[model samples]
Target chain A: MFKNVAVVGATGAVGQIVRRLLEERNFPAEKFRFLASARSAGTKLTFKGEEHTIEELTKDCFAGSDLVIASTPDDIAQEYLPSAVEAGCKVIDESGYWRMKEGVALVIPEVNPQDALDAKGIIASPNCSTTQMVLALKPLHDAAKVKRVIVSTYQATSGAGVQGTADLFDGSKAFLSGEKYEYKAFTHPIAFNCIPQIGGEKADGYTSEELKMLYETRKILGDDSILVNPTAVRVPVANCHSESITVETERPISPQEARELFEAFPGIQVIDDLPNSAYPLPSTCDGSDLVYIGRIRKDISNPNGLSFWCVSDNLRKGAATNAVQIGELLAKNL
Target chain B: MFKNVAVVGATGAVGQIVRRLLEERNFPAEKFRFLASARSAGTKLTFKGEEHTIEELTKDCFAGSDLVIASTPDDIAQEYLPSAVEAGCKVIDESGYWRMKEGVALVIPEVNPQDALDAKGIIASPNCSTTQMVLALKPLHDAAKVKRVIVSTYQATSGAGVQGTADLFDGSKAFLSGEKYEYKAFTHPIAFNCIPQIGGEKADGYTSEELKMLYETRKILGDDSILVNPTAVRVPVANCHSESITVETERPISPQEARELFEAFPGIQVIDDLPNSAYPLPSTCDGSDLVYIGRIRKDISNPNGLSFWCVSDNLRKGAATNAVQIGELLAKNL
Candidate 1:
């Protein structure tokens, strides 16, 4: 176990969840540190029945900490994480910054625990949307060698940040009351509508978020030949991210076989029962660490295709739980 | 011009829009009559600056009307539409019952106006979800024969009828106030939630709505060979249905070629400019008759695949407007 484990961005949305998860899961460490930006420094927070003051994050802050798990914006991770790695701390990052960088391990603990054990630098967790999808695809990929994926995501506002949920609730109240609301988290009013664009434009008209689904899956699954076409849209749901995923494999996997594969896989729960209105929904899957799969059926368009719906709490399985799980995996290996 | 045009289900959601569209478009008819079920039989509705009493819809109501445009539940259409056909009136149905009937001609005016013109019996308007997608696919199919389509829909509550929107608004209000809400139109909560199921279970685990996207597209486009895989989902939007659609054609169609094709297609408007965060959104596409297309890009999964985002007013182009356009088409031919 690490002598001193530091939680970066401890007061932010995913940060709070990470703190709660680490506490709830009883993370093994000799010492715990909570660090945030200067603005949140000196604030009081409770962890494991004790009150602790938040510390301001800096280049020299990682001196004593042996393990660092960070959840910050891209630029913040880019600037501060390397310092932690150089300071001899084993780092796991939640930001998108280091995931695609060469030698920076992108680990979903259940999908690839060995990668975390072998990582030399900051290990990165996949994006909220990408994490749930890749976790669902992992079993299918192992069974049938998934060749292509067509996914359209119904992402929750929480993926944007805490302010995204604030915008959704407040904007919805304003819409109901016929009042104008100035949204802070999204350019479009996300109260009762769908925003087709998630991240900024990347090459070939794909958003940065969409490309991550493609590139991250390739990296995590360690299969560069697998093709992915993703359209990530933000829906009004407050927590879990859901996906309508169709997978084409080297061989066709029937719905029954897919159900078995999903049930046997770790971190996945199958909730498919269409005739009775049973399926994995955002409302049902919120706050859960497990990825839920439902609506499993044959992809009528292709002979080698199978389709299903996937949902997982973006903040948990997609972000915090994933990061904490990585931390636990490392602790086990240590 | 018809001596008398009868509008059916004139008090419901799509019925109200059909009334407004007829007035706005100044449909050529010497006289107009409104018909509804016995519950709303004597209700007063104004059309073209004239107050008309709603007549009870019955087997004998087709007597003086030379043309009939209907937007009613499937059972009502199943029972009454054949009678209108027998009464020597040109009938247009917005219900799903007659759409897949052997003699029925499923039509989208922009895509298949000739089918509407050639129909000897009730002309059927496609499902709201199917209409928007097929309209978007028509141009691509024309340019390069579309072989398979995979579409996931972000359908709005209004497509569930007036009560659906009522549930959304009232449920959202209740959710904000921390009160319990009993949903009327959906099996699950639709406020700030996404329901993966749209219609009742049909064969092969596909919902009736999903099968419509497949069967209806085949009928409307007059191609039984075109393969379609659809996942229809209901979102919190009050108006307009959006879809993430990927099409694999017989030949490769570049994004530039697809955009040009979409721009030239009737009833399609291109709004793609990702760098500027410009794309088709449900909030922006509401209350429009034309289908909006954006996020046009290459489907990285397939060599011959092209993908796009489509949004259209489900009440207008999906139902009322398409039915009214069919009436206009038959009138012009006469």
Candidate 2:
């Protein structure tokens, strides 16, 4: 069994959560190691009451490790993942670099654990926005094949890392105090506003974040024929990301059936009581890992359409918890 | 013409903007009077550097007024608009109560000023969320004949009035200071979160605000065949409302042609240059009466589709400015 585990980028936001989940979930890691960039090499992080020093990640960092989990940027992950895989350590990466690559499995454990089991060297978790969306769509797609998805995201600040949350607080305070401060984390002031762009421009005028949702959803759900139209906007919330999703299916599915399917699915919770004002909002859904689905109703314009609201902690279900879940699934066969 | 102008609800948020625009636009009003609720009856507002005492809005307040421009609550507008119209006063109302009524012409001066000119007694302006949308759609629909629209709105807190803005500022300050405060302006916390429901529940699971976008769009555009599907979400912005819009037209309209159409149309500005990140954001579009459209692209999922982003100051262009423009139109005929 793979008992020796190492977490790359150990001191980062998603990395801290991964470490915490490993301890909280009591994964069978007999020995644990931490790795990060040279600047953070000597930093100490607590795991199960013991302080572990983060080492500068190098090719030899994964020599004795049986499994490696990375929550690094695209360039860092791309640079270090091959070395870890070559050292006979199984790898799970939380970066956009390798997700679209051939021979790599983009796994959302609740939707597709089989992809993780069939991984070749490196398994990838889908982007933060894509993970929650596919989790909500998988069961419904099985009942009625999804044809098109029109989504507008109200993403929180934490998706940009800890710096994003800081920028939100600092920018908001700047506006309130009548002080001028340049927005550092995002392209514009994220306080009291919504920016329509999340990532740099990509193919055909879509941002990289929008493209991630487009293609990663297809890969994770194992359906390439699904058409996804995404408009990703950044809101000022600290943690959870909310989506207004309108789905058109090849077969008709009523809102009741869709609600039941979401409720019965794993890692999904239905909070859709309108009379109680119980639809998912970031204030209520933050700090949790479940994908909260609510406000389900049929689109009156299209016969095969159903629309709903979804929210989930981008740091948890969207990133770390999903990566940790994949680690759990991979551990079963090890 | 329109020499005696009375602005009802003068001490309120939208009413303040209406008073400002009336003065700034140099409307042909020789005598100006301000009217508000009984509580604000003794307050004063300025018009063209002249102070006017706000009187209590009563049935007889409009007796000598040639044009009554009102920005009051729904019930207040319902109670007073009829009396104003019966007292030899032409009225332009910024309330949702009479907007969808059988004979009340819902006017966006840019889209349907003719409807304002042919008004029976009281002309109605569409909801703030609907007004910006129909302004962006009218020029395009005149070119390609719109068939269906799917939109998600990022509305500002000012749409809820001054108390809503207070809640946002106070709620955000509380959340930042580690204090718990319940949201009063909205059902959920609007400090950093987005609330999906805008108004009370209405027909077929849509909020009243959503239904306003549905019926008001068709009414203002004078095309009852056009279908609109809207998801109205209140964001943290204090002034501007943003929208992610996808339109399916009878014939395909390229992004270039749509940009040209919007550029040529009055009361609309095209801020779409992806390379420069010059799209319309709330921070830049606030306090302006023009509807700003950007991020225009062809929706690859459907052959006859185009998608874009829109932002407008909900207070200026959507409500008060629109009402004032109708008053200007009424002045022309008087």
lDDT for each residue of candidate 1 in A1-334, tens digit (9 for 90 to 100):
7799999999999999999999899998988999999999999999999999999999999999999999999999999999999999999999999999999999998898999999999999999899999999999999999999999999999999989999999999998899999999998999998999898998898999999999999999999999999999999999999999999999999999999999999999999999999999999998899999999999999999999999999999999999999999999888
lDDT of 1 by residue, B191-292 (tens): 989999998999899999999999999988889999999999999999999999999999999999999999999999999888888998888888889999
Best by lDDT: 1
Which stretches of model 2 miss by more than 4 angstroms?
Answer: none
Fraction of true contacts retained by every candidate, in order, equals 0.90, 0.53
Q: Which ten residues in a row have the lowest lDDT in candidate 1 chain A?
A: A196-205
Task: List clashing residue pairs in candidate 1.
Answer: none
lDDT scores of the candidates, listed in order: 0.94, 0.90
Candidate 1 accuracy as lDDT:
0.94
**lDDT minimum window of 10 residues, candidate 2 chain B:** B43-52
List DockQ, one per candidate, in order.
Answer: 0.91, 0.75
How many clashes in each structure? 0, 0
* Over 4 Å off, model 1: none
How accurate locally is residue A185 in candidate 2, as Cα lDDT from 0 to 100?
89
Residue B90 error, candidate 1, Å: 0.4
